[model samples]
Target chain A: MTAVSATPTATPQPRNAVIRSARDSLVVAKRNLIRMMRIPEVVIFGLVQPIMFVVLFSYVFGGSMKVGGTTDPGVYREFLMAGIFAQTVTFATAGAGAGIADDMHKGLVDRFRSLPMARGAVLTGRTLADLVQTTLTVIVLAIVALIVGWRVHEGIPKALGGFALLLLLGYAFSWIGALIGLTVRTPEAATSGGLIWLFPLTFISNAFVDSSQMTPWLRHLADWNPFSATVQACRQLFGNPGVSQSPAWPMQHPVWASLIWSIVIIVVFRTLAVRKYRHATS
Target chain B: MTGAIYAEGLVKTFGDVRALDGVDLDVPEGTVLGLLGPNGAGKTTAVRVLTTLLRPDSGKAVVAGVDVLRHPNEVRRLIGLSGQFAAVDEYLTGRENLQMVGQLYQMSGRDAKVRAGELLDQFNLADAADRPAKTYSGGMRRRLDLAAALVVRPPVMFMDEPTTGLDPRNRLGLWDVIQDLVAGGTTLLLTTQYLEEADRLAHDICVIDHGKVIARGTSDQLKARTGGERVEVVVHERERLTEATEVLRGFGKGETKVEDHMRQITVPVTGGAKLLAEVIRELDSRGIEIDDIGLRRPTLDDVFISLTGHVAELKEDAV
Candidate 1:
């Protein structure tokens, strides 16, 4: 009785697409936002961990790292901000993908499936909400940093630009989280699977240091890392642009590259996550 | 409203497991059709397919004249579903649980709030409406879950063993609520393992085994298929049991089971009460004084056993 049909192409509509897509997105986003608000512990702790990471690294290692030609511990906060922002986005987004795996474990998504609501809303709403939460985490950490005497050298407009750039970059980071959550067996597994990437990706990039301080190959890898590029752009917005800060090196428009990387990551991981979610339920 | 639920050859598969092989179901408006099956027999799968949670591999289903496959949104607007477990967020209060569900159905702010209170009151959860569901009793939670499903007041409802874990009293309470809904001309498709539940609730019972429907008929029709009513004869004295068993075997050409320990002999009664009278007379002639003699009608249990060769109690890991 099973008739197998080829997969349908998910073509995005062009005209009046903003309104249509926004409605679709809100339908997905509202359920997740309500659920996240209902469970305050997850939201609070999820936001807290990133703040702790930022403060801990800034005080403990910031004083020692020679960054942007300064040995002062205060200067490292600028570098740490970019890295911490990226890390927080990863941390917050890890749940978006895993929500499905968790719901499957708890049979919640299975129940949701019985309803006639859009199936995609479960994943779509969750990822977007996580993106919003990640954005909030960035804002919170920014406040804490500002109070601790950290300031972005760039003007007000650049800081806003940096924030916008980082938001899109964070949106991209969550796509990977979505993929992990959908592909893993349990919420624990999804979480561990998702968080595992952050450790290696964050550590290898120039999130907390000048790439030149590391070995030549590690520096090269960090310089080319898309994760690092995102942090570089954030540093630029925060008046801490990496290449420009180093007087000997000619600066580059890494923001455009960061956006490209974000788009690529978003498209590829979203495709994989949706496919995995549909197949998991099917 | 002619056919609240209509499915033809509905099929759903999960990897190698055929949750639903090929099942067809039809229930006219305002009728209850019990989808009875043991665990893993795909009863929940059928419910899922009908509810549009899982698309059928190949089939056509329409609820309230809307093709479920084509216009699932419209179908969603017309029906409510209560899965095996309570889907209410334990974090939300009982009132909020209903309110959220009402909102999902697009009920307005004031309407959803009022409906939530009314449902809490109807389900006997008015006092606990402010408290989180995690603090509720098992019966209260089940009632709230059932209440959440009714918040939309959909014309058709799908209940997946709504009374399975409830105590007898709670089960009766839910049964009363269901009866009230059915009386109000609501169509229902219920999946259950309880023989008595299906017997008491469903106007038509479908006995499903191995992911396929094996039997479908009214409680009486299925009972009638078990041949005829059973004649149970009990002997006062232990020694009269042997003679009574033989005497009962002689009354009619029907299967007889003799329990020497209990001093009882039971056999199918082909000629009804007259046959029962003949058995008593034969025992009387044999000087076998009988303590009791009576005819017992076939029950849903008997029907299940006669058809599936398995009692309903073996509901382990089902669903």
Candidate 2:
């Protein structure tokens, strides 16, 4: 070991602290990613549910559900892909919450707190790692979607934009999960809390059945939903049906709505989650 | 700095319960100060406040010369804390856990790796370095957690009940490691419920109860406060206990306490060896056959009983 001062003389400058915070977040993210790798089950199980959703929803409801007034299995499958992709990314919330609650339960967060690292790095790192995991799950789900006759007719860049939007939504929701994870005492509670509300959130959106078939009030609620906006934007970018929708601003201007919704969620939830973290630990 | 770790009039409350009530502490550099207390004695709460993990409602602490509330980050840089719970990541390998801690302390990648390896070896965790800490026994996990705290080798360290659940052998091993750290110039403030642990390791011991410092001194000094040495004699026959008590009272300084079931009589005294000899001779002359007789110095247990009006609660060991 090298001889270093008990208290390092060079206190990190304000500018340096920002850079250090980013670096520390990456370090923590790396640890989380490594854990997912070593366990294998975390990623395996994460992929399993979305794949099940892809296969089950495609085969089971392909012919029955109507998309753009067509009951054709082929057309409906493409429409279903957008919903599955959105669902997969958002479903990652439960896993993110469970991960954090587990860490707190085991006192790992306490260990991190005792160190001289940036305060927000731990939560940011966790969400970042969950983002990476969601990315991988999305890629694998995209491949499964393609196999099941879902195509991106809009070409590569737009397709990439669609995937990027889905990821943004996922990353945004992961912050909500982070907040729940911080609040809940047990991982089990976090898991249930993360998932229970998400069911109605995704179901009532433009993701699954075209919200147009629903009654007036249900249609209105779904059209205005932020989740519905992201789903609608992905459908447009993917060059799939259901792009033409009601006059709700979020529905009509889906791309801007998706970006604005995700950005707003990130800003609001990240602040709340970080505040929750400091309070819970303190 | 006058003391490596110093605090004055520290007070913290959770709802209605005051966890720390006007607690003051001063641990000189390169020495060990043991905060000895029973369960919920606010020892852990004090450590949390001093380590900047929790804010105190009133008073101040300067750890390694950094004001805890004003410059918590500075205090963090100069101190390492191993909390009451062993705070290691169960998913990470022992080596990985240490490496992560090293990186958090801002050590370079290569430096972190090197330090992690050194710590694994130093803590006798090299054999299990590659294993996930979830598979580690309680003692091994504790060693890993302790190693994590030492990753940056800060000048001062706070260990809250560092050896609480370990078996005796592992406890001894940890004590050795702590002593070595102190020898290498690390000032330490360790909280423990074990009197024997404080007696063996602490340069000074502060006994606390109900969130306040009840007594403060070296082991011998605190023992002396309860009174001087005691003369204890156990008669072979229960009927002869009265004779033994009479003989003990002749030379004893305090009231003679007789236990009929054990046929034992104990009395406090000032003169140590001469008092013991006189008791033995008198008991023998009075036909009080003895099972055992000895002069006993007061232990931390007795001091605790004297100060708190009760025993230290968790008497896992006889001491």
Write down the C-alpha DockQ for each prediction: 0.20, 0.46
Every model's Cα RMSD, please?
Answer: 5.8, 3.1
Error of 1 at B22 (Å): 2.2
Tens digits of lDDT, candidate 2, A1-282: 111254442232334878899999999999999888888987998899989988888889989998888899888889988888998999778988998898888877877777788889998999899999999999999998888898998999999999999999999999999988989958999999999999999999888898988899989989988899889998989998767569889988998999999999999999998877765652
Per-residue lDDT tens digits for candidate 1, residues B1-319, read: 3366888887777778777778888887778999998888889888877777777889889886778889776677677788788776676689877776665555554777888988888888999998888789888988888887887677788999889888999899999999998997778999998988999999999999877899999988998898778898888999767767777777756778988788888887678878777777777877888788899988888888999898866647555
lDDT winner: 2
Worst 10-residue lDDT window for candidate 2 chain A reads A1-10
Candidate 1's error at B94, in angstroms?
2.6
Tens digits of per-residue lDDT for model 1, A1-282:
000011111121222445444444565576567668878888798878977887788789877888878878777776677788777776755677567567677656655555444446567777788877877778888898787667878789988887887888778877787777767758888887878867878898878777777887777677777877778778777776344342222125668868888899889988887777655552
Clashing pairs in 2: none
Model 2's TM-score against the true structure: 0.95
Per-prediction TM-score, please?
0.86, 0.95
List candidate 2 stretches off by more than 4 Å.
A1-15, B285-287, B314-319
- Candidate 2 Cα RMSD (Å): 3.1
- Flag clash pairs in model 1: A28-A125, A63-A73, A97-A178, A97-A181, A98-A181, A113-B53, A114-B53, A154-A239, B39-B318
Model 1 stretches astray by more than 4 angstroms: A1-38, A116-119, A213-221, A241-251, A271-282, B233-237, B250-253, B261-263, B270-295, B313-319
